[model samples]
Target: MSHLNVNFLGIPMASPVIGASGTVGFGLELADYVDLKKVGALSGKGLAPTPWMGNNGVRIAETTSGMLNCIGLENPGAPYFLEHYLPEVKKLPTIFIANMVGKSVEEYAECAAMLTVPGISALEVNISCPNVKVGGAAFGTNPKQAAAVTKAVKDASSLPVIVKLSPNVTDIVSIAKAVEDAGADAISLINTLLGISIDIRTRKPILGNITGGLSGPAIKPVALRMVWQVSKAVHIPVCGLGGVMTGTDVVEFMMAGASTVQVGTANLADPSAMGRIVNELDEWCDKNNVRDVNEIVGTLKA
Candidate 1:
């Protein structure tokens, strides 16, 4: 049998596939269609200090190959998560990584400080969420701010810190280095580039927020490039995610410098996509006569 097992950011994953934040809706929701334990890990929707109702009407808008999201981080807030979701999800066999965002450095550190549970595997500092009106991208777009927030969260948490990065920046590698210097155990990118589409007739945008982060097949190439750039820029593990849909996409990410890849919009098309991708990964590696999966991680072909 092909080896599909791997370790991601110090957490032992059953495989190399993980569900991106906001796609799985807090693990408990996706427990019916697929077994959460089979996945590499689960990153919940970006959580904030307070619960968000999200933007008004029409949270999702379709594009040529991908989609735009105006979901605005509509989560149950930190207190609710620590009280309601965390305790219950901790029992599941899957690795639990909380995806978090902050309006201020202190706020980011505060949430990290409070999460003292042994069940959660790590802290994913989401400095790149484009679905909100505050803090996520602003902190991520600048290399300096990214480092500051990363260090803040690192100082507060005992769990390994994985900084989620934004693709809307000038130089992604610079930002990658910044976070690594701040003590990120691993880095994940690129979180949906800022994009928008207008309603032709009304001359208004399709999403209520007028703009959103685009994710799906359309952004895969760009993501692969960034992952390749950032992985070489820092020694930390890079978890690449953009428009990953199949085994080929996963392999591409691995070769381009991803230690792991997260499947996002693909899940919206098919819930069992992650499982199928894992199966395909084994066959692909076996056919190529690859002995160890990690051999290809960050081994970009010239």
Candidate 2:
């Protein structure tokens, strides 16, 4: 039998296919359509210290092969998650990761502390949100700020911390190395590339936020390249995500350097995507005579 099991930051996962945050909201809603246990893990929607109303107007728009989202990390805040969602998610037979975001270092740390309860398997620090205290610059864009946020969250969170990297950075390797140095247990890369769409006839922006994060098959190449680079640069494990839509794509990522992979846009396209990927991965491994999925990680010949 193919062994699909892998440990992410010491958190055991039956499979390496985790439901990306913002795509799988707390894992409860998806339970009806999917078998929660079949998924390796489910990351909660990005949460903040306080509830956010999110961006106004059209927050999502369709592009060629992907989609743009400026949802602004709309969430019910840390306390609500701990009280309402975490308990339900814990009942599921799958790993649970809390994706946390904030406008300031202190807020990130505070939310991390609040979400560090026993049920949470790990804390994923989302540095893609703008840092209002720092001139609205995204924490992940600056190596120094990324490191600072990682350090602060790591200090406050008892659970293992994973710093989610933004694709907007000029040097992803440098930022990945910085987080590694700041005590991040692992890293997830290529959150989403900034992009925009226009309605020519109306001569107006497609999304209310003007610019939004682009995700889908359109970004797979960039995500793979960054994952390969960051994986080689940092000692921590790298979870790759971009436009993965099939089992072949997951295998490609694992071979490139991803210890694990997240299914984001695919989930939006199909609620059963992650489960299907898991089953497909097993079949692929069996056909290839691969015994352990972990063996494929970072095995790229280069």
Candidate closest to the true structure, highest lDDT: 2
lDDT of each: 0.85, 0.91
Query: Residue-wise lDDT of candidate 2 within 1-302, one digit each (tens)?
Result: 23999887887788999999999888887888787777889888999999999999999999999999999888999998888777778898899998999999999899988988888889988999889998989999999999999999989978999899999988999999999999999999879999999999999998999999999999999999999999998888999999999998999999989998999998999998888889899999999988999999999999
Per-residue CA lDDT of model 1 for 1-302, tens digit only, reads: 33667888667887788899989877887777666666889888778777768789788989999999988778788889888888788877788888887778887888887764678888888886432344334888888788988998989889999999988887888999999998999999989989999999998988888889899999999999999898888999999999999988999999998988899999898988877888788789999988778888977766
* Residue 108 alpha-carbon offset, candidate 1, angstroms: 0.5
Best by TM-score: 2
List residue ranges in candidate 1 displaced over 4 A.
Answer: 129-137
Candidate 1: clashing pairs of residues:
none
Which 10-residue window in model 1 sums to the lowest lDDT?
128-137
